[model samples]
Target chain A: MHADYLWTAAPLIVSAPMAKVAMPKLAAAVSKAGGLGFIAAGYHSDHLEDLLQEAEDLLQEGTAETPIKVEEGTPKFLPVGVGFITWSASLEKALPSFSRYCPAAVWLFAPPQGFRDLIPWATRIREATACRTKIWVQVGSVSDAVEVVEAIDPDVIVVQGLDAGGHSLARGASIISLVPEIKDKLQELRPFPQKQIDVFAAGGISDSRGVAAAVALGAHGCVLGTRFLASPESLVAHGYQKALLDASDGGTSTVRTKIYDKVRDIHGWPEGYDGRGLINRTFIDHLNGLSEVKNREMYREELKRGDEGYGVNGRLTTYAGTGVGLIREVIPAGDIVKSLREGARALLYGPHNVSKL
Target chain B: MHADYLWTAAPLIVSAPMAKVAMPKLAAAVSKAGGLGFIAAGYHSDHLEDLLQEAEDLLQEGTAETPIKVEEGTPKFLPVGVGFITWSASLEKALPSFSRYCPAAVWLFAPPQGFRDLIPWATRIREATACRTKIWVQVGSVSDAVEVVEAIDPDVIVVQGLDAGGHSLARGASIISLVPEIKDKLQELRPFPQKQIDVFAAGGISDSRGVAAAVALGAHGCVLGTRFLASPESLVAHGYQKALLDASDGGTSTVRTKIYDKVRDIHGWPEGYDGRGLINRTFIDHLNGLSEVKNREMYREELKRGDEGYGVNGRLTTYAGTGVGLIREVIPAGDIVKSLREGARALLYGPHNVSKL
Candidate 1:
């Protein structure tokens, strides 16, 4: 596994920073499976201290119960990171927690107008935690990458594609071209020591082939959200799992709408960055004039009526990436990690034989 | 082209039954560019005589106008076919055109329960026309293919994937496996000439690599519809063309809802089959409870408000398959055909060395 990680290997599989869904158990399982895990700091500033203590406690519990067994004397506690939507954490209130935890990696999603304001602050934490808690930023477009890389100069950058099950920040280009373009941009940046920056590509990375393709495209790792959503450890509803299995081919059927964000009363996201979800009944009726429902009390009541628990009605907006089509069943996060690794190995080193679909 | 069609080629190009869009000019453009083109027969039993007469007239016109000189006896007019959505054109309604046209090929979309009814009817047409026209059925699922192939015994079978834009009659197994499975099933059908049974794959086939992959997987040819929807000759409105161009990297931010269908009053579609259209302000509002809107009288007023000129809104349903994502810009039908054919040839016969993407 270590050899595969260094050279001639698939990416280091990392779970996505899915809000509410990225629980401690899911994170622990990812770390246990030799993959990176993230605890999303979504609207968590109010409870940051307790959240960090809980996450740290879980990591310690996992390490104590099942020590990393790669070799007899080698260290056990694998790396675990924490992520936050950039603008959300930029709030004056969230700054204390952001400074306190100094996570293995502080991942930023949906960055603000400038990374400069955030980078210097994050650098203080990096210096405090000699453990090299690197700073990573998520970007959707080539220009986004160039902008962030030039400003913040994060240790790692995550390139998210449209295929990802969740909200994609991609406004221009695609994951196909974005990866190479980012690599070229990094080469052009040409910082001291020819900075060894890592680019992690996220979204629609389900099986080994997807992971292999990402690595082949110059991504050091793959960040998977819906892939983990199908894991047994996930907090996702049972009906959602059934929907994932029933889905055929690449699970690419998704609609990015701001309805849920508006309905749930969750704000702070900029325009053009909507969420991708299944078209349920509530969504159907109000899709045309959301402003009508948003403004009118009566229409809002009608939407409330359809909010039955997951699968009972179409109103429950199950957030999934395009990769949901490829997931046929729910399994342990660790099992998925093993399968992804093994699948890539077989594709790379296995005999040149065609397998029947 | 004929030699490759018989031996080395795969069926990746799909001729759009554009109804009015499939004029002789459009058909000739695709055919002369070395791709298959089909004439559409939609609610045209009354016009079949004129339609066939016009088609022949156009073929002669194309032959006389073709710039490149051929060998002494090469057929000037390339192979052209006619297609009908089977369920839409009931047997009694469409048979007159089949007899009148005696096309080189006859294509049917949507399988009926009594598929056996098609075999003898098709055979009668073949017998009368000296077996020149081949019977081809468009199906969605492997099971649908099995049922139809077992009952009708068509000469060619088209496996339409979920990626196909517009109304799909088939369900179950995706186009990826569906193509190979149909080929295998046809081979197993006793008393049939297996080599003569060509299986073509359709849906989400917009580029050269897709065509090459389909051929490599044993498909006789590919079917393209969404790709052609953007062609200059298509009757679709300018707004529709702009929308198609906006759908880049095959990334379609669309929701498959019945809002437009209900507003337009086009009924009799199966429950599972929904249409994919651009996710705009209008679609999001009406997707959920259009059933209520359907029950109410005076709903036509709201529908009228949504309509723009030339099928932009409620008037047209923006019929497309998943291939809409691959389309970047609107070009001529001739250019699309020529590029696809030449692109496939290059990939098939390109240089020995290749780099991983």
Candidate 2:
């Protein structure tokens, strides 16, 4: 089943699973647009199962009364997937019920808990469905990627560069440089047959040009998070969305930082993890020499100023990529997929078309 | 004259003017391989005229004695170019004698000295030869790129990403993401009669994969550095070359850092500039809790252990890219260019060829 899907069902665009941002509506919208869409299973430690169940039910809500027999190799949900912070303590408890949601595939990120532990999760998913549920592991460093291929054998290895949002590897390589390196390493591992691992690029990719670049850089596909952050279906509040749109004029507006994480009272990311986002009030204040403890105390009160307890309104964290400058509007998720597909097709052709470029 | 060169003389590969590393032989070899090649005019404050004279004479040395009356758009020195740390204290001294070199183009990096200041330098070149000697300004930020286009009106804009070796922008965006954003902004500036500025991607680009990716990301061309560090023509020391080869495996052997600058006794890098180099013994020692001053003291001694009192011995720096892991051998510069050009061609075509990928 996995072989069939990997061979035929690959899509040109895939929406990254964003915690709190990627919900059922966004995932379904993207999936419906012939792109893989995923719900990020993060932060909702105890209620993850319930959230997954809700998302799956919402995805299948419009199915025909007499379910048509699904074709082999073709996706039942088209492109619905689930992503996880694999290092989260909640993963062990959340693992057993994942098969119930019937995700087309699972994207596991930041497995600092070690690559071997991922074996049990992969085994469980494969065994539970009695069908091949694809396993994709994200590795920040090439060593970890090698370990994944040798130990667990993931269908896809995401080479996460230093320029990503939310939780990024503390010291990661640039995506374009890292992808080909990883591909070469994987080839050396399985010489004859050649390790058939698809490499997906993430970090600083926000537009059709980046997508096309990924394919050209020997990646099977690319995942976008910050670009989708401003899509209508994303849970980003109005204030954060405005900050994103305002930065579209071109400047050093966003940066990779650990400041927001400290102010948000979020704690305990495994060693070597940082976040990227629009440089907000808190970051500037901290850079200006405000103490971390004092900044945290001030942010606690400032958080109450906004409608929700999160945003760029006061000292809130606005997770985004450096490519946020390119995002100008909050359109539907499906429309983003369509525009990206069309734009990439237009730019990626030969000289006759690229001359205008 | 500028339009003719930009149109007819476009090449598939180009060697960047790397400080200290790029020499007469390396530049000439790259140009002979159908790629633009450049000599870096670095730290030659007193003998600026003499060095340019030597480089120019050397570049034209092997030319046909019956000089074929160079065509209008044809390069006088073929593909020979000269680069400068534009903000250097020596640029004023270097500027007056640049025409002597008869360069195809001048690559100016890190103009923190302000974009407007670059105009007189550009005007001087045009006046020197009564022809538009194309001016190229390196920018780390979009605003600087816009400034260069609108004010200085450089014929080419090199997007130097954060992953590049040697001196780079303080807080720059990734190359892939920045290229498209700058392109969009330039389009808005000259909407109808489109601004025909070409984008060149630099930083972390090693093999043909990076070149293909750059073109797909809207770059007219790409520049390579670390990959060429191992090229026999490169002037890098034996110790540095060996360290580069040993690190050609999957590991975090390189990083973007500033520690090297301090240890090397190099000073006065305008506020935000740093470097990307191999994580050598010095990096490991400092990480193990040595004080910054003590680390510097140790590096000073370790430096003297090598042939030229430099290298990866104990506390020396090996300036390179995050893709240093991809460089394995010390081949000829022409072979490196050939392989990169061929590899990029194969990967950049449509699905008919990429299916095996």
Count clashes in each candidate, considering only residues at least 3 apart in sequence or on different chains: 38, 0
True contacts kept of each: 0.00, 0.54
Candidate 1 segments whose C-alpha is farther than 4 A from its true place: A1-8, A11-14, A24-36, A45-81, A86-107, A110-223, A233-328, A341-357, B1-8, B23-35, B42-81, B86-107, B110-222, B229-357
Residue pairs of candidate 2 with colliding backbone atoms: none
lDDT of each: 0.59, 0.71
Candidate 2 overall lDDT versus native: 0.71
The worst-scoring run of ten residues by lDDT in candidate 2 chain A lies at: A65-74
* B142-210: candidate 2 lDDT, tens digit per residue: 887878887877778888777777778656677768888888888887687444677788888888888
The C-alpha TM-scores of every prediction are 0.60, 0.90
Interface Cα RMSD, each model: 7.8, 3.1
Q: What DockQ results do all the predictions give, each relative to the true complex?
A: 0.06, 0.51
DockQ of 2: 0.51
Identify the runs in model 2 with alpha carbons over 4 angstroms from their true place: A1-11, A61-79, A193-195, A249-251, A307-313, A349-357, B1-11, B61-78, B192-195, B249-251, B288-293, B307-313, B350-352, B355-357
lDDT by residue (A135-197, candidate 2, tens digit) is: 888888888888898778888888887767778876667787888889888888877754467
